[model samples]
Target chain A: MTATVHRLRKAAPSLDPMLALVAGDMNAVNAVILDRMQSQIPLIPELAGHLIAGGGKRMRPMLTLASARLIGYTGTRHHRLAAAVEFIHTATLLHDDVVDGSDLRRGRRTANIIWGNPASVLVGDFLFSRSFELMVEDGSLKVLKILSNASAVIAEGEVNQLTAARRVDLGEDRYLDIIGAKTAALFAAACRIAAVVAERPEAEETALDAYGRNLGIAFQLVDDAIDYVSDAGTMGKDAGDDFREGKMTLPVILAHARGTPEERQFWKDAVEGRRDSDADFAHAVELVQRSRAVDDTLARARHYGQRAIDAIAGFPDGAAKAAMVEAVEFAVARAY
Target chain B: MTATVHRLRKAAPSLDPMLALVAGDMNAVNAVILDRMQSQIPLIPELAGHLIAGGGKRMRPMLTLASARLIGYTGTRHHRLAAAVEFIHTATLLHDDVVDGSDLRRGRRTANIIWGNPASVLVGDFLFSRSFELMVEDGSLKVLKILSNASAVIAEGEVNQLTAARRVDLGEDRYLDIIGAKTAALFAAACRIAAVVAERPEAEETALDAYGRNLGIAFQLVDDAIDYVSDAGTMGKDAGDDFREGKMTLPVILAHARGTPEERQFWKDAVEGRRDSDADFAHAVELVQRSRAVDDTLARARHYGQRAIDAIAGFPDGAAKAAMVEAVEFAVARAY
Candidate 1:
């Protein structure tokens, strides 16, 4: 590992503290997740369990739980809402695997690989529907509106990404917009709804939304950077997957913007799926490094990370508030 | 058409009068549909319009409208709810086409065929999320609960069907369970929600649900039987699509049960996907006919049709009630 990576590993706030703080609520959220995933069709549970039971970070639901507690929510509805958040995230992952034709997720065979694309897609739908049910049971139209709108935005982002994929000319603004819709929108909603359920004022709701939105952006930026820097084992997917899939993430877009004419042609060929050998990947990585794309990507992530911290600064100092602020830092640090 | 079909068509009450009865409300529903489908991304509206703008019977949404009118509702929330119902149905159709590898729907090329599977799946998700947004906007927790639960059940039924696909030994009860989850559940929810939004008594809600549930069962039964007896032109989808996909619809299941040893082997080969030629389809049809599977399936459908009519007998006589009764008869008559 690089010195930066070593420093990141040491300096980043451990999620263990946050997880410990919310252990009871997180436990309840997990129970709700397990209970809601059951269906009369055995395969529904079987396929869904394979994905949901896999040891994902549970970061989104953790955000919901942490945000709810940060705002002093004492009700059990946040547990259901957290579960709903996770279900929506899980559902998207299942569909994303199908869309990307991925064979593995979180170091296990993807559900699509095990059950085929049809089952994955349908099960994803089931999880999504189940998420709405949980939201309804929460009995807050404001919460429902936030999460439901986020769902639509997420789908819109996926479709927008599809349109932008393999296009060398994609701009950074468009890339940011795509990530905002696909990833940050849910995070924003997850945090905003915590305030809604707590009956917090609109200002707090907006502040929490801002915090989550910036954190989500930072998270995705780091994820994209990690793809360029990390190996298959560390990334939990094949190295250079975004490149192979023609995804126009930040590093590629930045590299393309900074490349010479021949280098630009190289990126265009790679993104259009004309270049896909190990040697080609190596050359692409070298070009990206030569253009300092990863460094630039991380800098952008840090910018968002700082904004996330700023967004939550008005909240009273507490364990939940401190962990949430640290989460933004950790999101950026993960790239190193 | 056969003589029996001709006679059935003549005796069946026309839906045109029903359609005309709620034409204004349906027009409002369509406006909501058109408005919600719009997105700045451009491809979303384009792809969704291709499917939604293509003509469909709009049966489920009509039930929402009719049921609301049946319960003497004067509010406009049902219009939004009806649009939400159509969005859910359309979303399912998009995903279903991908799952079934279907190229045609409603006598036109399917969205997946025009745009790849990824676009279709993502857009379908967009529509689903949009559906939830509409439900949330309606601001009725009961409406949200009914629709959300139906969505989950529909997905569960789809997964069940996936598990049961190509299995020659699928039982009648299992088939009923599958259809109940996938098709009838939504129908039941759509009608029940009309009562909910109208604030009708629980008994009336139960009655409307029963009416929709039986109507949906009869509708699907006729659909399955039509696949065996009708041509592609009449069926919209290619004839024998279920057989080609090795779907264990009621006809195939019953035929498998009643076949001779040799005939059973034929079904086994066909259902196991070892038979897919024109000659195989012809022979499979012959076996189904010899075993009287279509006749039996239609008989069962008629029984459900009668029950659907019986379910709504307590409603006061009116044009809406008359139209709904005709809908049940119309559902069964289509198979003839």
Candidate 2:
């Protein structure tokens, strides 16, 4: 379902290869996720399951599993650690919904909308605490340190984003810093911990971290690009949602940077919540297209995508390596 | 400033002894707190400082230090751990304010009111994550497990309390369960971790756990009683806050159980948010007084307070022991 031409295969790049590589490990991770999320308070699981069982791709945990396979670590410790990573991700999503007052995610009602913000907040806290418990059970202070630091960075990035909200002047450097912390930090930690569990050396740990970090940036750039490009519908996101919310995504940054003075004024109005009508969004699309902002955004995604693939190039060639490469390809190719 | 008579000296019970015992260590813990709450993002430290620097009693961290002192472990490790405990407590308070939609706490505007719910929610997440980071830095998996489990239990209790909100039929057993998880779990964990860090035996850990747990319950029971007995204002809590919010505390539970049919209906209306007028609260207080509900609640507090003191009876008799006993007395004596 991807559009990028593979130089060697002439076929579309897809995540199927990575999914196949980690299917068994993924099952183990899923089981741990379902098992640990249950609580004596029924609302805890009910609210959590709505999102956990919701039909989003288990992208973060899959990275953990895939990274384990790439390193040829055949132990089962990543199963629990992968589940912990997913729990952190799920907790972040639940809290994000509350913070944004988001009613829908991935074509489903958010937990906050269904269960109310208080439940969402508390259950999110539950999952977060549970994630740490799982890490402690794994008995790796190193892993605990990594994940906990990622969590703090994610919170910091969220606060940064919150404070920077609706400001058209939030240039690319600050925007990238925001996404690096909020999105890439966990992906990096998720992959890095696999190395830690495998007893891999610092070099491998750092390489895997780079791989996940770069892929995460690419993934987020595409997601942000999708918000401005209505026809990018293969991904289940509803375009213009960010526009309506006046979110300052990279495309908005690029479009504002490259626009005429009048166009920059229009962009500022849109970001500041004044212009959100369909016609306004349509004009926004026209302006971004005229300035090639979406094109450059995807170009930036591909740049990071290439870095991700190269980060793992030193690993021995095998199905795992090929799938990992194709996964980055698939990530960057989605916006096409 | 406390009313309870000490058997040994015929003097009033007070926290001054305990406060004096931990004064030096508390400064070190405070230093750690001030150092760690900083962030590159200005708003994080800005919002967190407003509450952390705001005049909180630092009771949870003080418990950690006091427990360490009682065990005669002269290490300074509890300084950082105690700060971590205080962070966990502050995070909980921030989220609690958001959950309760409370505008004031400790007679000052809450973080949610001064900033907003979004800031409070994110900063709470930051502090929670930061607390785990602190625990991880301490490099004790045992401590991590205790604090992590306590954190999860606190979230579960919060969800339980939310679901049980505005329900007059919430009996004593369920109310105890709720408070046990919400309030006592952290207290137990805070005190228990001191033993873990001191390398004390399991028996000491369990004893400290019981001491803190029972004291937490007694502390809460008296706070609930104070809500009904508005003239009991030495605790700095604005009494009758729970009544207006339709909170079903122990005082309401006992009063409803002892009320006549008409009085029960009034309580039903009060707990369900129908009866919140000043005259209604006055009549409600009169009913609770005639039923002796507040008196019995304080009696229950004394029961737990005695249990708390007895739990640590095996520890050596020293200033720490006397201070700990008087602290319990000071807690349960507040309602009188």
Candidate 3:
């Protein structure tokens, strides 16, 4: 346990500095989130509160806040926008839990489990609508266009993932495209909006967008890797959930690609046939480890993480920029 | 069959005149809808097409088109906004079917039944995001605000209905609030967007909103009444679906209000206790008939229908206005 703690410490710098830097803004964002989530319909607040109150790290919203600060945005619009970003994220999580038939989130029972799929889906719709309301209130057409487009793209990605589920032939480029649309589009939108509100130049906007897009790809790649390497206690979900659910994440795709004919047959059985017993999971993990698929996935994540750092190279050196860079590293290093 | 056809013919004036007036714009809206519903993910279009092609009366989009024509506005933006309205309604229907666990819609299998709940939820989300994309493309903040707020209210109403499900104590006022949010909010927003895009006076906007809101309430009241009075062949869903699902629609609420001790007990058993069977549905239908709940519900519907006419009475009499008035009558008379 001590060694594990020490290794974790050496894994990467904490997000503490970034969190601290934007703590004041984050508090305001939280207030908006709490206030906007309220509804006269009791079940809405009750169901939404269960998920929001479970308190996952507000990583996406932090990116919005951090990017805004990095771009030297001085107005209060970013707070509302940050809250909007969190609402969008939370809304997707609710619907994703329903779509994934997930049992646990953040080590707690998912809202869908407690309230049923209907409530989760409806509350998710409510949160999504509320996010748009916030965006409308922000009163920026450019921002609205960016965020709304990102939302559409996110849905497309989810559908693409659905189509790709359980297919052994799922390619790496398609996997990246799925993550790019589902995860990075929002990250790009969230950061780009800071530039929009800051009234920054197009180049700055593009830079921040690239930074967010790459960071988001890295974040998801590392997340897929962590599923293979981490335990349920650390990952907040059972290991090999993707395998059981027949999800085609990066490591699974890579491992399948590099595996022997026998190993390939094993994946087809475990994933496509859904023969995911404990033994199957154990064997799958061993195969993935042997193929160095986890290492390859992390390497890809680091590649994107570095691009994220490069995307913001044009920005002047500042505490916010430093923190943002550390955040990219932190996202990648989580797999270690 | 002949007698039923005669009754349906006498029950309502057709929406054909209104549909005819806006046929060109409606065609354009359909084109946009077909165009926008497409995604690289084949499953999305495939699933959305199954539902969209099943062909419910495009009444909501017609409302937007007719409302725009009523105000003598000449713009193509209404076509897109109307499409957006239909998309919102369709998205809600997809989600609602999932929430209701419905098996049939429009005399066909439901999307959830065909594609599974996960696909339905995600595709519903895709449609919703697409709706927002349309709204943003229309590029009106007022329209965005109205539609987005309506979306939020719609979800809230769905949650309220969930909470009120199987509860015999739900009052009429709460019932009105629920339908107002779930059904009428979109109608109101749809009609109001016509005025918004036309840059009409505040009075015109308010008047259109009232017309749509009251019309929506009337429409729902008649729909609930039809569930008891009409057969599955006509209603495109099994009769007594509301009763079977323990939904607190007006007819059920009214029947409960007017029932004797024994009948009330029967409702409690069939609805709240989830003991509904074919016999229970038959008995419930009989009790509703005896209590005149269907008639009373239609009377309430007519009252709102009349108010919808009155709300638009200030407008000069014209073909557009006449068609709008006929729509209200058609909504109420559907219960006949």
Candidate 4:
């Protein structure tokens, strides 16, 4: 192993087993996701297939498989669970693009832009329903409960974020709460369910859930941080896109708090009003950088990344745990 | 009993027993719906509440309660189930308004009009998730399976509708399939679930499902028929509005098939193009009326209504069963 992997393995040995299982079956999980997303409606299936095949990191599904492996599951149910996770995530993305009026997603034209908001929203709902159907096949009420709750929390968080936009008072705590609901809740549920389906001990299940939640927080924090610094190609979105949209990400929240009076006033006006020009975006980015918001936000992400590693302290030594630790570190550590 | 209570009791003896359990308690269900629907965002909750209280017939929930009673259910779970059904229906309406870009609904401004599409879409997601959460609380994996599957089918049907828009060739078979998924599937599932929850005989469960399915189909057919004939207040919307939107209701479809070459081309350009003005709408309505499309469509609806009554043939003669039968007949009996 490379020095980075070696260090991660030494720090969190439990990740090794999970990584082995995930790497071994990544292709199979992808196949399952594709197969189940197909609809009897010819146009729907074709459109959904094209969107699903478009490159995505598939990070949420990885959590499901990894958690199951960590809990010593040998059944194929994890594969179904992984696919379900992907479907739910994809459904949310389709709806999100429509709601956000976004033309681009993951460095490509969004489904809503191609088909129309009506198609995307309805198809997104289709995926959500289909995901539940997949979970039902497992016959686990606990799994359904976890997922259903997570789905509700995710929706609530998105609504919260909508209200949070352009508000000067959005703080770190609310930010964490928003990200937890919007992003981490599903990740946590994805991992927790992996353990639950395997019938692991409650302690281990809780540990895996914590790990997932912390990892998700780290992922989103870094995402927000990168929104200020990275280009469209690297970040899979335009730079300062959130600023233009008046979204109150962690970096912007921090920057606003630490800015001078004039800077704060600029942010308030910029966020509340539409900022469509390059100069407007550049101004937001400059102010964020000047206030050290990016650095502070990166520090917060690293903190959560470390918390993720700490959450899995009790798992047995393995490659899965190690990779998970490495992945969390990589998420926030990279400049991009 | 008061006259209304006596009338209800006379019509549906089985429903009398169930109403004894649920009538006074429906407020709790409504409260649950309202509480769960509240968002941190002012616009979302404000608009959602207005629409939720917008004089809906609330047939889905009543069907849920009646079905559970028919199956001898004694548990409080039916209330939760009823609320979930209503939430799902409401969520769909919210999204549908946005999809149709409708300014008016039920003779009032639509949620999308008052709150904007973003809030409507996101809040719709909120209600969808809330419905799932309620289903989870029922602790029946079987119920979750039924509800989620129905939800997915509903969404798929919507996507199919979106793609089929403005297509003059959308036939009866395809229309039936779409409505089955979009409308009847949930109605069928709602009844089926009551049987499942009450642990009724398999045959009885099947019968209840058939009853709901036929009833729902009839209900939709009547709704479509009324679109061409009923006035705004009586039908709860303007007359012949479907023509303005280019929606091919059953009457329109029947008339189109029976129209002369000139009439066919007129409909093809006007309704399908969604470019119909008052004159065009008047002409189309007049043509449909003269072609006997309204009568023909009503005959089709009555056929399903009869089938709905037939599906309940096995049930013992009781007030509830009779009322249920009346409900089906009433669905298509008159415009109101």
DockQ of each: 0.82, 0.87, 0.77, 0.66
- What does candidate 3's lDDT look like per residue over B1-336, in tens digits? 121111112445877779888988989999999999999899999999998888788889999999999999998999888988988999999999999999989889999999999899989889999998999988999999999999999999999998888888788999999999999999999899999999999999999999999999999998888888755344476687777788888888888889999888877776685657878888888989999998999889888888888888777778898788877877777656
Q: Tens digits of per-residue lDDT for model 4 on B1-336?
A: 222211111222233443454465577678777777776656667777888899886678778777776666777777888889888998899999989999988888998898788778888888888888888888788788888889988998888888777877788888888888898988888788888788788898788889889888988888888877846355577876777888967787788899999888887886567457878877877988899998888888878877877777777666567567667756766553
Per-residue alpha-carbon lDDT of candidate 2 for residues B1-336, written as tens digits (9 for 90 to 100): 443433322257789999999999999999999999999999988999989988887989989999999999899888999999999999999999999999987778998998899999999999999999999889999999999999999999999999999989899999999999999999999899999999999999999999999999999998899988878667667778889999999889988999889999999999889999999989988988998999999889888998888889888878998898989988888776
Candidate 4 structure quality by residue, lDDT tens digits, A126-194: 888888898888878788888888887888888787777778678889989989999999889988988
Off by over 4 Å in 3: A1-11, A230-234, B1-12, B230-234, B273-275
**Candidate 1: docking tier:** high
Poorest lDDT segment (10 consecutive residues) of candidate 2 chain B:
B1-10
Query: Which structure is stronger by lDDT: 1 or 2?
Result: 2
True contacts kept of each: 0.91, 0.86, 0.89, 0.75
What TM-score does structure 1 among the candidates reach? 0.95
Error of 2 at A93 (Å): 0.5
Q: Candidate 2 on A210-289: residue-level lDDT in tens?
A: 99999999999999998888786666779899998999999999999999999999999998999999999999999888
The CAPRI-style docking tier of model 4 reads medium
**Inter-residue clash pairs, candidate 1:** B5-B336
Among all candidates shown, the one with the greatest DockQ:
2
- Those runs of model 2 whose alpha carbons end farther than 4 Å from true positions after fitting are A1-11, B1-11
For model 1, how does the per-residue alpha-carbon lDDT over B108-226 read when each residue is reduced to its tens digit?
A: 99999999999999999999999999988888998899999999999999999998888888899999999988899989988999999888899999999998999899889888887
Q: Write the per-residue lDDT of candidate 3 for residues A287-334, one digit (tens) a residue.
A: 899999999999999889888988898787779988888888788887
**True-vs-predicted CA distance for residue A202, candidate 4, Å:** 1.4
Top model number, lDDT: 2
lDDT-based ranking: 2, 1, 3, 4
Which regions of candidate 1 fall more than 4 Å away from where they truly are?
A1-10, A230-234, B1-10, B231-234
> Chain B, candidate 2: TM?
0.96
Clashes of each: 1, 0, 0, 21
